[model samples]
Target: MADTLVADLIVERLERWGVDRVFGYSGDGVNALMGALRRAADRIEFVQARHEENAAFMAVGHAKYTGRVGVVTSTQGPGAVHLLNGLYDAKLDGVPVVAIVGQQNTSVLGSAYMQEIDLLGLVKDVAAQFAQQVSTAEQLPMVLDRAFRAALATGSPAVVIVPHDVQQQPAPEPAQEHGVVTTAPEWRRSQVLPFDADLQAAADVLDAGERVALLVGQGARHARDEVIAVAERLGAGIATSLLGKPFVDESLPFVVGTMGHLGTTASAHLLGHCDTLLIVGSNDPWTEFYPPPGAARAVQIDLDGRNVGNRYPIEVGLVGDAAATLAALLPRLRERTDRGWRDDVERHVRDWHALVEIRALTPADPVNPERVVWELNRRLPADAQVAVDVGSCVYWYARQLQLPAGVPAHLSGTLASMGCSVPYGIAAKLHRPDRPLVALTGDGAMQMTGLAELVTVARMWPRWSDPRFVVCVLHNGDLAEVSWEQREMEGDPRFADSQDLPAFPYAAYADLLGLRGIRVDDPERLGAAWDAALTADRPVVLEVLTDPAVPLLPPFPAGAAKLEQMRTGLQQEGAAGRHAAELLETYAAQEGAGR
Candidate 1:
């Protein structure tokens, strides 16, 4: 067998695309590709995940953490099908990822062959920007390059499908022929700024209002200084979408914190009272938390025009790079001299900080989940990376865990996929082994896929430089988020059969893998447990026995209605819900007292 088959050429092209690693699992469909990867191991690395789905999640995480186009591969049929969940995660969160999937021989495709699948059709939705199949060796170069370019241009996942027979073909060296096509793997981002007229229009709106509020999202990540400058100029209070949390320093006096269902009371107050809104790089879907339709005159700035007025009606839409747009608008904006709005915003933030402390200290059955996250606020290292999964754990992560400046905390933001924390943490750690990573996940999510991904951690931790990977499992035997959603949204009691999770010894499983295990049942021990796990010699599973009854309450104005719904649902639970009702009331009382 020649060493330079089409498979070999494919690996070479990936190297040219600047992909250092590819996450995947093997099957018969991709046997040729695997052999080529093995032969070219020095240049491109291969990471084997526990499952194909997890491999896809790793790819998404890689893009989010590394700020590069992530690459993933899998066989056709079942393997190709499993990549959908993670591909959706990448698409929904605007992360760039490229999936190279193997297909059955072209001859067998229409014959209904054993492993045949309509590969192009399968990835159409998730890889909406680009998806193509390589029919000839000569087609490989163009297909691969376009996938990379399209992914970067659109900030979404792309796909390249190669047939099993196509993989065995000799690497094509196309000469100057009529039908031949070739391309280069290169992508560059432009410093796109808004038109001068639009920038002036945006400034006019901001100059008119005294009580201005700025809402930011992940798109503002690179423009932190500019965002703060704009907020300061307008005497504006800042509130973030959860995806934008890590980009801004949470300790800022006029920063009201994240605004949404699991957001801060200060954020709710800021949005509720503001007369003018300036949205920067965020299309957060929580419309209820925004200033009511006619309450505020809004100006939105985003590079992607599609999100200009996506969640809110705005008087001005400035489509441009956030930093450049903000800088241009700054010259036209007159600085606020009243300082009254700034002082009120700072006071609200100060009150919020104290209220959170009281909420974290509230009594629970064994341990308050908020306390587990609150303790990490001060202990998080300057360089630590955080990966959080969806569920009640996200509520704590969103509201309690105050990220240190420059620390990145990523989750399955828009897709809200559970079981992402383990895979995301692994990908971040694998990319930068020198830095420590902490994953916050609920027990329901832990049981879904985290338990299996631990084996991947056990297999790889010995190769790491820091060797510190902490997986904090909120061992509350319930699907708390959905349960609360049912109560809050539908005014229904918790259906124990659907919400309860089977007990699993997360700590013991870590011990089985020869990693450290620490279980915390007492609230007083949360800080010590966090300290122990952060400083451990190897991977540690910090399984926290958290309370499921702690209410998932939104900030006020919107939260008041949800609070009534929750009480109504609890009233119907009879004896089964008395303890939960009491806990809910206690939490509600604490919020009032703290405020």
Candidate 2:
């Protein structure tokens, strides 16, 4: 019988799990695995990344857009260390990623050999599951299978540590014959929780109450119609979490806009006046919305039984699929005495819309990030898939951008790491070649993660039939503008004056990567530049020199406090403090202006 190496078994397992490519860097510890990949190059391609962090970020983007398991590999020590940041981002963002890291030989596991580190302990916090492969020949398939399951089932990143000695060992006959196993969780239909009784109870509360509101989250994505149905039925105003924004049209009469720090005044007013609030598929903390104390009775519904009342006191908590629960309750819900509630909510929504037009998009001194998102919403293709990295850009895009039905957006990170934009862009293009993919990143974050993947995109463009990606960098050259405001609320006067970075020539970096680069300092040119990039048949970079003075439209006051703390720390301390203070001032001046 031919000698089948453990490395071959690992590759075979990955193939069975339907992984066609792995984004990673090569190292001495994983040389045998690299060799195995070379032999099977025809079936699975190994994408050599400049850094392991970029590889992990790319995997996240791929998984988010395509609904496939993102795969990444790294060597021991530093290589594995670099992966932690990106993996944490994936874990937080709920992206399913499978990472394979090489370790020193099993014999020297305890000894401090060259490049040897306790990889399992290092990644325990960031990874959902961590396992060390002891025997390349015996435990290869078992570990790989478990790693894949953990990542896919929980929508989190998992790490499998492959020791050098085991990877080089010959696999047993049983290992070679082992096939991949996948377990699909049975999704039972949402159970009816005494629908008539719940509906009657809810209707009684609404009828007796003068003001009412509806709150939605990601759980409401599929039940858009039902959400609208229930809102109309109850004559309730609607407010959504960051994840729930795209689920309903903002133009709808009931939409009071998003609720949080970035929340509109009208939404806050409506929430403040509500006598009862019905929550669907949302786990957003109440402290964020800051509902007026003792203002309303809360009814919550969610998929997971535990999440229903985990954060806030609830008068009623229903555990089931949001859409199913709403569908069952809608028939029994009675038309209430609140005749003009919908009209009132609609009027508030219209007034807020006018305010947004006047304040958010006024051709002002410094361009608003909100207006940029609005413009992108107007100009980009209806089905364009957008991947947003963390920071100010997240608040802007989450609150302002409007996605068409069926279009998807990716966010969430275990650690809220920066520099995810470029890698995500690459992954989006790889998974969905036909759709236009855009990466919205802040300047600081872009500089950290962008350049590394430009080369990768350049190399893959040919294979994808001239598939393209547009990278929009909001080049403000600062960090944490929104954090400054939160500090002020907490009584720290000095918290709002720190966090900034020296502006770098970002367009030049794009040019260096052989991508079509366009730089725009004036907001007027943003539309044209973005249009040109979208129309181009290749990868393009559009760098917008945003006002350094623009503050991020933070989602909550707490986030604003963090920004303040970051700023204060930057100003009173060393070089880092000064840099932070500068960034905060830039953001403070631009607060409410969008960008």
Which structure among the candidates has the greatest lDDT? 1
Candidate 2 C-alpha lDDT tens digits along 212-275: 7888887687799999888887888899876677677776767877777656656766776688
Q: What root-mean-square deviation over C-alphas does model 2 reach?
A: 5.2
Distance from true location, Cα of 301 in model 1, Å? 0.8
Compared with the true structure, all predictions reach lDDT values of 0.92, 0.72
- Specify the highest-TM-score model's number: 1
User: How many residue pairs clash (N, CA or C atoms closer than 3 angstroms) in each of the candidate models, in the order given?
Assistant: 0, 35
TM-score of 1: 0.99
lDDT of 1: 0.92
Q: Which residue pairs show backbone clashes in model 1?
A: none
